[model samples]
Target: MVTLRLKGLHRVKAKGRIYWYAWRGGPRLTGAPGSPEFLASYNEAVANRQSSDSGRFRSLIALYRASADYKKLAESTRRNWGPWLDRIAGHFGELRIAQFDRSDKIRPVIRRWRAAYAETPRSADYGMQVLSRVLSYAVDPLGKISSNPCEGIKQVYSSSRSEIVWTDSDIAHLKKTCSAEIAQAVDLAAHTGLRVGDLIRLSWSHVGEDAMIITTGKSRHQREAIIPLYQGLRDILGRIPKRSPVILTSSKKRPWTVNGLASSFSDAKKIAWPKGDDLHFHDLRGTAATKFYVSGLTEREIAEIMAWEEEHVARIIRRYVGRQAAIKERIQKLNEARKS
Candidate 1:
């Protein structure tokens, strides 16, 4: 019997076969010695393990990825964080976390990412935010890093793009060119005031006889709500075949991954919406909220219906609610005062 010692390779015997896995955490890889696949797996594992043990960015990110808090993040947020985190881990991942904690040391790295992603300032800013969280996690629970370098770094806000309520024309155009799944996704997003992430995860079980009853996942403090199963949303739901556990499915009848949904929707937008300024799926949620307000629902009432905070509902009203209607209400007060 020979004792095998490989830095990142752990050999385990299962079902009369041996398997190798990266010591830190990753997918399993198998390659017999002297085989090309084995060599590639070994090399890749060694690299990942080296970075993992180096007490660097990947090490901290790995910890954060495995955290319960990470799982608690909305699917959209988690999806957004992953790429930015990976990019940060790639550039600064080699440095020790302590080394990364130094403001002076990390400034240059931050500057480069900012410069590189200058066209999309929000992405750069979000990268900094993700870095801040990763460092914070390392400090509180993992206790590996002492300071958060992302805190002091200034971030820009160029990603703030205004949204338009999808018009009847817009819906008609989309319906003409897009698949039923994507078009229905559009309808569901606008008709229900739920975020795209929440809408995509809606299940058959969440369906009620006259309403959609489910807990939304936009924020950490999740709240359940029941929106009436109106004709539009009900039509979309009724038409979608029960292919997977979730109501929203791809043309293949498979469930959508966050990236897949984003990509598919983006493609749909480009093809079906070639005429003017494109609308984001999230704008539909805002559009729904504004409709709720114009339909004479109070901000608090809207909040209750949407399972959102009153403050959030108010914010949406401030941005998108009809100003003419607001002025009309104010004029009624003036008329009352004259009558008095």
Candidate 2:
């Protein structure tokens, strides 16, 4: 048995093996002693659990944590929710859920978030949205909270992007300079209009002979995606040797984790755009939308390819590429009039 000196922490031996456990009966530690899990679990077990039944806030959060809905969420989603929910639990955890009214408590908390994360105001907005959802759930047929305090909370954050489309020259330079891995990622994003998350998670099975099917990530709805497998995407996939279940692997031949992929792309981007253009991996989706428009696809057809709403597609094409086309046609007509 390996013994480590730590408060409220000990190792138990059974069948010639030692296991770490919290001294008092708490959740079993999952990692090696003195690891991240050990320290977190130790602190959790030994921390003060002084809250009583006086407030339904913590209790309601606990109930929601154990609900089927929270449990069934995708791994990436639940991971994103952890820190946000933990913050909410820490902020008003001891207050009664029914008393979360906009007149005082809720607005104050929202303002605090807005002020604290002024640089990333979107994060603060997201926190309010999360709180609102919990409040809505509490006000549902199952719970005692009568109203959602987060209703009509103004979204002060503007998510407008000045992302420029990657020209053919830009894409060619990126493919030549970038590693074979990320180059392929860029190509798939441009041709198929898939997000980085979806690209990294894509499998050989998802790519049929003529079309690739996908379940989109990071959307309110898990949209069914079906984009045709064009020659560009076909050539990219054909050359890559399959080492993992995921189609795109890292230089180490392992499947790319989301953060890992981002880091790699960041490095590749510096090489590709040395002058620091305002392009990102996601900007390829807009590039794809433009390319579809130039190829004579209607907004409705482009919407189907990208799995986006028709109105959004129409607006984007009109604002960016389609308007330019219309202006050029007007100029051509004016030239003909002058000739007459």
Candidate 3:
């Protein structure tokens, strides 16, 4: 039952889309301010209350409502999803709420966006996914549209296909060459398989007597990773002062950004080994998942430990478990030879 009333569309000089002052007093436009075509389109949509159908408009209204219930998301989830929401807003900020439908007109827009970001499939996939969700929510339950245009969109953009699993040497080098904070970050990634975004911001409060209870941003699963207080992690955690809220932090004792940590990890990797960029922090999670998978842990168990959905685990296996079967077969042959 979301309603949007159009105000006047004004032309902006730079990269401006249509700007409509809503009945609720918020401005809407398709693109960022200052794009020429954006300004013209904003004015056109506002002037005539264009009855044209668009999925973008419906999606925006749903997003607005969803944002109102922000508390439902974890702090990290909010931080990550915010950018996607902004990008969607930038593309369809000014459309009439009621005019949203699956139209051929928007296909080219999606196609263009997909093409522009062909190299980075993950970003493109995320954009499409957010758009799809928005549109799905906008569709009337009474069969207004036969189907969502976003259906069957390829996930080539947001996939783990490009991800690389870390080797033992990579782990050893990172531990040896990185700073204390960075080393701790690497250890946590290795042991817990948490993302840099989640690991760097983790606090003593999230740790309990037996395990580290982490909430993932990529999904809603609440995972409690049990890293049996081994000497290394225990020693590292023992060194932290009682006053700090996080495990890895700056001299000022603040959380680190994912990019910042990734940069540091990269620098440390370069100094520690010949191939610094061979692996990413995310690969640690993949490695851990592989370890569990090899140990005959069910996909559900791996997902529980990693805080990923079941399908995500399957996807990871398909993408990265290349040598697992070969290694298992080699072991089997060795065992048969020994028995003979």
Candidate 4:
């Protein structure tokens, strides 16, 4: 029979095999070495192979090592999945991959995450999505698991409460209250529905004499977005230095972080706009869409210009198209008067 020993530790031996029992007294295995029965058999085979000088133990070690899934995931995907993977690793504490029942293993984690983020359900939902993506890679690419544990988990509910649209008076108040530069950024965002990311990344090269082409950052699917240089927006762009690529950068010429922009915007609003009329930077996008709808642009046309789904046109039309028909009638009357 094979003798088993550890440095200041104990081991079990049976049927000419030896094994170092797990120190924590949990299971007879450590770190995904296959099933408990498989581990036992592997130990016996190792002892036999050592006595016979066979390659059986070496081949089994290679096969078990090959079963690890983390190697197959892409670098970018691994970076994105890192936090979730670390959490899972921390909770399990070196458990065997084969020992886990996908649902039973992850459901409790999800439950705890949900409870923690009860007030902000979106955070919980995002956590689940991150976990699901990692599990998908583990099951599909790594082949460590036959099925993804993330499958069929009910997606956490989130609210989509619509934000109030900024009014003309609000815009005027903001312009009057903010510094010339901050007011320009506010005005440009109001005129174009470009995201804050796209807004900050904009370079002088993107802005020609007649129009501005924003390299969109949201989906990065649209390639580039085209916005006409209206007279007011052109005047703002003119005020910015010709050499600076970013239109709204700080003195260091670096792009604004979301928090940085939000803080600047908050300070600007507090000084310029009246109380109780405060709005977010995103509200400018809504205001821009509202203006476009009221300016005789069709819903389909607005969707194209704004990169919004066509389904949103109805709600936008309802919100902004009020009183526009009267304005159109007045314009028609003015044209008839000129003709007469």
| Model 3 per-residue lDDT at 181 | 72
In candidate 2, position 66 carries an lDDT of 58
Better of 1 and 3 by TM-score: 3
TM-score, per-candidate, Cα-based: 0.60, 0.64, 0.61, 0.51
Each model's lDDT comes to 0.72, 0.71, 0.61, 0.59
Clashing residue pairs for model 4: 32-96, 177-272
How far out, in Å, is residue 340 in model 4? 25
Question: After best superposition, candidate 2 residue 166: deviation in angstroms?
Answer: 3.5
Which residue pairs show collisions in model 1? none
Residue pairs clashing, model 2: none
Across 1-340, the per-residue lDDT of candidate 1 in tens digits comes to 3344555564555446665655423435666654678678777757775546746567777777768878788655765676676677777777767776677977787688778877887776777788788888887878776777667677687433333566668778878888888887887777787876677788899888888888876665468766877676777777778888898899988877677888998888888757656577777766676567656677787777688777676666666544654566668678889999
Judged by lDDT, which candidate is best?
A: 1
Name the better of 1 and 2 by lDDT. Answer: 1
Q: Candidate 2 residues 1-340, lDDT tens each?
A: 5456776664556446776655522224667776777777766745523343636576666666556666666656655665677677777777766577434666666677656767787887877777776777777845566677677667768655533677789888878789988877777788888777788888988988788888877553467667887776788778888888888888999999878989998988888778787777787887777677666676788777777767787676654453454466568678889999
List ranges where model 3 is wrong by over 4 Å: 1-113, 116-122, 138-143, 155-163, 204-206, 215-245, 249-263, 273-276, 310-313, 316-340
What 10-residue stretch in candidate 3 is worst by lDDT? 17-26
Q: Candidate 4: misplaced stretches above 4 Å?
A: 1-81, 88-113, 132-158, 219-222, 230-232, 235-245, 249-260, 272-278, 293-340
**Against the hidden true structure, what lDDT does model 2 obtain?**
0.71
lDDT of 4 by residue, 212-325 (tens): 876566544454566778786787777776546567775455666666777888888777754545467886787787677656577787766666667987776554443554
Ranking by TM-score: 2, 3, 1, 4
What is candidate 3's lDDT per residue for 1-340, written digit by digit as tens? 3233334433323223343332221234555544655466556544434543444363454344344444366545544555676566666656555434545655666667666668887777867776675566556442444556677556764445334677677677667767877776766676676776678777888877866777765544445554445465577677766546777775456677777777776777788776436576677777765666666667777677767667777876666554654378559779989999
